[model samples]
Target: MKRRLLTLVVALTVAGYPSAAVAGDPLSRMTLAEKVGQMVVSYVYGESATSVSAADAAANEAMFGAGVTTGAQAVEKYHLGGVIYFTWSRNLTNPPQIAALSNGLQRAAMADTGIPLQISTDQEGGTVNRIGAPLAISPGAMAIGATFDPRTAYDAAKVSGTELRALGITVTHAPVVDVNTNPRNAADGVRAFSDRTAHVATFGVAAERGYRAAGVGTTAKHFPGLGDTTVNTDNGVAVTDETREQILRTHVPPFRAIIAAGAGSIMAAHIVAPSLDPTGVPASLSRPIITGLLREKLGFDGVVVTDALEAAALGDYTDEQVIVGAVRAGVDQLLMPRSVPGAIRILLDAVASGRLSERRIDQSVRRILRTKTGSPYVVEPPVVGTPAAVDTMNRIAARSITTLRSAALPLQDGQDVLVTGWGAGTTTNLATALGATRLYTGSPSDTVIAQAVAAAAEHDVTVVTTSNAWADPTQVELVQALLATGRPIVVVAVGTPYDLASFPAAPTFVAAYGYQPPTIAALAAVLQGRAQAPGRLPVTIDGLYPYGFRAP
Candidate 1:
């Protein structure tokens, strides 16, 4: 009940709130389609929220289903309880468009099912951030964690939540509490706040409070933990071998803190922890983990959502397998099922065949209803990219620059510096900040490496930038080639902080955690001796550095 109101999205509440599902138990009135719909969220394929334009309609038919034209049509056809926004789906283009879309989706849901759709998206900032520019662009969890300031975490989420809510989105899947133990992990990277469970809990709780204050719902995600896995469920089966005891250290603390802090939702991860469930299904659908650990052990009495159901992590588990597994595991909301109508059918079939009881369905639906009807998430319109917000974002970035070698910074004023890296224009930003020539290249190639090496030889200092180089080895090869130039070298990881592990042989190393404009500017200012590299490592680099390592 505490999770239902002011916790965060029991959300996607629009301006001038809807009357549907406002006061009574709406389950008795809902048909089977509507009941199942409450357990699932559908993805719309268009830009407009209400009207399905010709392009929007065609795309919907091609992607989601046929004859589903608008948000209203989607709710009417599938009886949806939630809608998720993704930039890849073109559902989020700009602020005004998103606001209109949110209002439109709520209006359609109210008109059709007397409910409000919890409009959701991944706004974790840094790399997982879906919408960019014009919005308050802040760094990711790791970047904020680097500051070791609870207020920074709180302010960053508030800035993001304030803007997202103004655009009509009620739910943001963020504050990844996964205690990143593996530096090679692609899924958590900077998205995770810290490797230490206590730090993760501190930042996660602060962020949740910030979102609640902003009238948006927050999700403590990738549950039980995905910190040990190198790949995401989108790529392959990301299994964690951490025993139940091990989990209590790396995974359980942040979740425990958030639940106590009044989290509205917990998004189960697709990765599997065999100690929690020997069945090998993802944690998203694991009864031992979700119901046994999160619900019973952690004492979380709130809405539970599964990571995307169509993820490759589920590994051959069809919609039926996953839907039944998740529902049985106690997941309250299912996201991005390949087919919304088909997913609804699965729920109905499960209920009819006794694989899942109607009572179970009613329980999840009641939670959704309580969240939607409890309160209207109302907030004043936020100014996109305000100075104070920008200053806060920049401050976090400035504080998060972890420099490895002190002498390598403050590049001598007259020294010729050649800046080059593998990310598009990221190196250019670094180059511009340092007033150095930039030889920008896309993913590395033999020819590009040769060219970069030759150009580095001509400069007094060679600066190289890397983005998740731990995942892609080509950047490492390029960095190695640049080091061969025998010039003073400064290697800056503009993305994942783990990139330092890939090029440890470099003369100087710095981890920026993110490559956004603010981060790049901060790194440049730090290098120019205009500011201090005050950041400490949020995650350890195995044998190389300990957590909280800062340059002398």
Candidate 2:
């Protein structure tokens, strides 16, 4: 049996295929350099030296040395264990093309490494998608929560993961599980599942389950919670005032539930939890947060990853310091560390100098190996993508749009829908797609707002799309315009849902807790009465909608 298994492994390797055991074997044999390489996930860019013509061999060598490659040689030379597959920034929207490029890179990496590397991405479906333009889903997370059914959440994730896995991606950094409690949140706005922990927990866990069931590992991210911070960790602002009680009650539950559900990983947020750790270091590098809080206290056994160390989330730490601090903080992976070799050497040096223990290094590596061990084998007839994948996404999204009216959402061909909001474009797209005579009060004046408003005043039915755009003044202006149209307004919030507080007198309101494409379609479908809206409010709309309010 042993010999037969060995023969199978050899055969699989020769045929250029990946399996769970083969993927597991390399983890045990990895040297410190190799193990460290596995821990480092970095972005690749092409470079050339000495004016080497684009086709010149020396120029090619320079580019390869610069950590960029088209095929196998990169993995062999760099000894890379995983890659965050991204297109060259210039070409972001073309999914099929990106998918093709990623598939080729994965194949080359496997050919070079003799192991299937962990390919990852941030395909969070809304505005955060790496794919742009006509393919851009929605602008944020609140949109999806508006859809309300766990099954719809699952379907959305399944579709997203299917598209990613077809391109050879093994993991996704998504389902932005953060609760959007802070209306003035500097960054998390529409990206959070909701303001209430329970609802956010529900949406997050369901999304993770769906992704994993579809063969992609799910990462419940910004651990210890990111909803309370008023600063963007990406740009050097760091904060933490969530009491240990609040963290445990609200923020930590989703991470715990998802981890319990066999989530492959969790990304640590850059914000500091000051009550837990007085040092003010971000959770990504705090032993109390990562080790004591997550590992020991909450008992999350899955991989604990750091949010991008290159982000100014670290309080003025140098590149080397950031790497060392993150590893020491109990994070299993240092995501997108800016200096790969230098960071590796710093970690090795720290371990050598007794600043970082060998035991500590082993712990992180073991968790990483465990995470990899769980990965599904990537097979190749070479996964081909079709428009059907997008169709699935749209269908699932259509199901998530929630309808809260006592009466059915009445939509007729000629009804003038007074759609206005920060995410007017999204609702406008959905309204247009639904074959409605819609009106917009915003830009691209060629589009008819006056005609639509006049039509709304004449017709009793209107649907308004409005949202608090990170406290921007525009959302308020749009809502005021729609209200003045004096139609029976069916206001659809395609954002943080806070703008409803500003227009409390409006009737027939709907909140699609995010601005992603699925939410747009979901909202449109619900408004058209083609789908049932099952979601309850995941957050309090303070001064407007009460928490847990749902219109049957």
Candidate 3:
């Protein structure tokens, strides 16, 4: 039986399909470089399926390295374990294009390391929706949470994951389980499911279950929770000053729940919590947090991925320090290093210099390969767009449109309406639904503001849209200008639900929770009384609405 399994591994390797079948103690056969490569999942440049041209290979040279384009050469060169896709990275173009890229990259990975590439994207629905239009966009975590139904979260993930699987994307860094406790949290906003801890746990577990059902890998992210932070880790250092009590109550429960749900992966946040680990290291590099609290205490035996190795949260440290630190901290995969080749070199050197033991590397590789083989990284001929996903988005959006103050709702038929707000498609979409005479497209200028006020006077009803009015505050001028018209004003929060407190005078306030097409259309339907407002507040609006408050 042992000899037969060995023959199968050899056959699979020759066929460019090294898989869990090869997991029969394959670590003993792996070179140090192959093991190191298996731990780094980096992004490559260009929009093409293969970096065919010298120019294509050189496209991301300045950023990644010379003669090291993974989209072409580096996947084989470094034996990369996986790849991450992003719209800005040109990895995402259209449906077929992305699917082709997924297939092409996977082939390269198999040819190099004989291991399937765990291609991933941060497709956590809502404002974080990566592949827009032509693809099915699902409601985000917060919107699903507002329904007060775990099934909505499950349905959204399943639908989105199905589309994602069709794109040949095997893993999704989704179901942001971060409990958005701070209403003014700069990092999370509607990305998190709710400010409530238990609700976040419930919704997160549901989404993970949905992903499992869809046969796609699920990663519950920012493990120590970034819900209360004032800064984004992607930009700079973020500290979550949650006390021991707060950590046990607000932050840890969601992770505990998702781990129990058998999450495929958990991403460590680049947040420093003095209480969680007195060592004062970021969660991603803190052994107390990742290895101790998460792995030992919570009993999460899955892969542990770092939040972006290139993130500014760890900018203060050198590249070598960060990589070595992450490995020591028990991170399974180092995501988006500033330079993939640099990270590969760093890890190889760390092991050689006795800074990191090979046993640690082996542990991560076993988990990663297990996940890829177990969830099994479904790489089918991607369907791109599906009717099922579209239907899911529409239903979730319709269900999540919450009306806080409905005094000015069910606008008089054909009443002159002026629609203006703070997002691109949000206000225009609302205007089209209401059939407004004038559409002010969220361009907050003195001239635009004046024109909006004038138009508000001409129209019987003014529907104003806001995109995180709590932070930007630019929408305040526009809302205040429209308010002076002495007309019935309806504020539609197309981004975050906290905008209502910013404009208290508005007679009608609706929370669409996002600017997705389905969400905007749902906002229009609710305001027109064509559909009923059914969503409850998932987060507390200080001094006004409490969590779970809907129209009485």
Candidate 4:
């Protein structure tokens, strides 16, 4: 049967149908159950989960059942179209383990349907990286935007894609193209490239091209744009109040560019945009937005994936509602539905009842199968922790470090310098790189604040690192206390650029845009005058520094 199906697919491809659509030709060959299964992408634990603690093991069993412990088990039970990997859930340790896991999933999938599985991860770089440790971490989207060079975007994504492909991941949920115009947007921050539509479009296309060059599928995500929202949909509903014209002008351009560049998938945002859909439904469940706007208006025939169905924004809806609503909304894949079995049952029941037509289900299944067959996962030799990849990542980070205020640059060697902040590892690494005489690590506690202040008083210069200080009042208070010491301080906003607005009185400020080791080393080099800071602010922090601001 498998040979016969392969022969049919080859014939269709030779007949000149697009290779993607040819593999799933006639769609009538699949049973209703198998077709329904193609619309679902389930999550499974990696091999590393075998070493998890008793409590975590029990929790995983409770959530996914004892039978669904491994990717093969999940594929066997759910007949899923793809697998979504989470480092925390899977406890993934290294590259070899990830490759083994991918191969296992693919073998299981091939046995079931003779089709490859779409193995995917959120390798967005910086803080959101899941394929952790030893992989060369890039400086993320905003850092690439800070350089204002599309080539930097291409190189960063190509390296990232190469590493991901080598590990057997076929799809990367990355290159967030949202124009993060609102400085107060907590959800987007450094994840977005820039506030300018043109910048987002230009760099977004480049990143997409890089991913394609490396033989991995790229997802231009959180569409129509989550850049204007202050609330993260993972926790609660976020409403975008931009007028329709404003959205068309600002938020929609980058997605258009990415689609034009042939992005394989698009992840719809969970935020509500009343301007796009008058019903005020979150874009993930709105047919007007996904089908009418994205499909009809934008002419995107690629897969439309919803953000995780379990997000708090969809809390009011039941698992059945979300599964059915997303499909009815014209989504091709339902990501991380609360229960795989429950979702499958709901979809089957929806078709059985008059709630959903079988034709709609088949349409989605064909699109998914086409994507899977056309983009077969070809495993590359593992390249994690390779020297050449690391070098490229470090060079990109060095170029992305933006020195906003540099009155204290060229710190004298052997100077009495105190380094302190959140992300203790980054602080320690930067301190060691800069030859700081002392290091104090602390969160925003009263005791830590007191210790930091005393240490600041004793040192010739103080270097304070902040990761989202504006959001954490404790960090804000700690920085304020350090500033009150009347000691010369160079503040390093390592996570988000907006931290500078909270500490405007600091003598000098630098925006690293991330906490990766390479970015930290770049920050250290800039302080020691070993490297020049060339990055420009990607977004305005209002009352602090405007976009494109950099020290002379």
**Candidates 1 and 4, the one with greater TM-score:** 1
Q: Rank the candidates by TM-score, best first.
A: 3, 1, 4, 2
Q: In terms of lDDT, which candidate is stronger, 2 or 4?
A: 4
Tens digits of per-residue lDDT for model 1 on 44-67?
Answer: 866776575687788777655777
Which segments of model 3 are wrong by more than 4 Å?
1-23, 52-55, 374-381, 441-443
lDDT of each: 0.81, 0.65, 0.81, 0.81
Residue lDDT tens for model 4, 1-552? 122223224323311221222343546666677777777776775463234455555655665677455557567556788888886666366887787677667667655666667889899877778877688888888888888888989988998998888877888999899999887788888898898999999999999999889878888988999989999999999999999999999999999999999888999989999988998789999999999999999999989999988899999987877888888999989998898878888998998998999999887876776566443433433667689889988988888999888777768777788788877688778878777854555566798788888888889998888887767888888889988888888888887888888878777898898888888888888888888999998778788777888888
Error of 4 at 514 (Å): 0.6
Enumerate residue pairs that collide in model 3: 166-382
How many backbone clashes are present in model 1?
2
- By lDDT rank, best first, the candidates go 3, 1, 4, 2
Name the 10 consecutive residues with the lowest summed lDDT in model 2. 1-10
Per residue, candidate 2 scores C-alpha lDDT tens digits across 266-378 of 99988877888988877888888888988898778778778876787664778776888888888888877766667777877887798988777777766765655332333
Instruction: State which candidate, 3 or 4, has the greater lDDT.
Output: 3
- Write one digit per residue (lDDT tens) for candidate 3, span 1-552: 011211124323322334334545767777888898989988877676465456556666765667665484667777788888897778888877787787677667655655677889989988887888777788778888899999999988888888888787888998899988887878888998899988999999999999989889988988889998989998999998779788878888999999888898999999999998898889999999999999999999899999998888998999987898888888999998888878999988888889888888999989987876532223444565667778888998899989999888888887887777776666666677778854655647787787777778777888888888877666887887777777899888877788888887777788888888888778778888888999999999998999999987
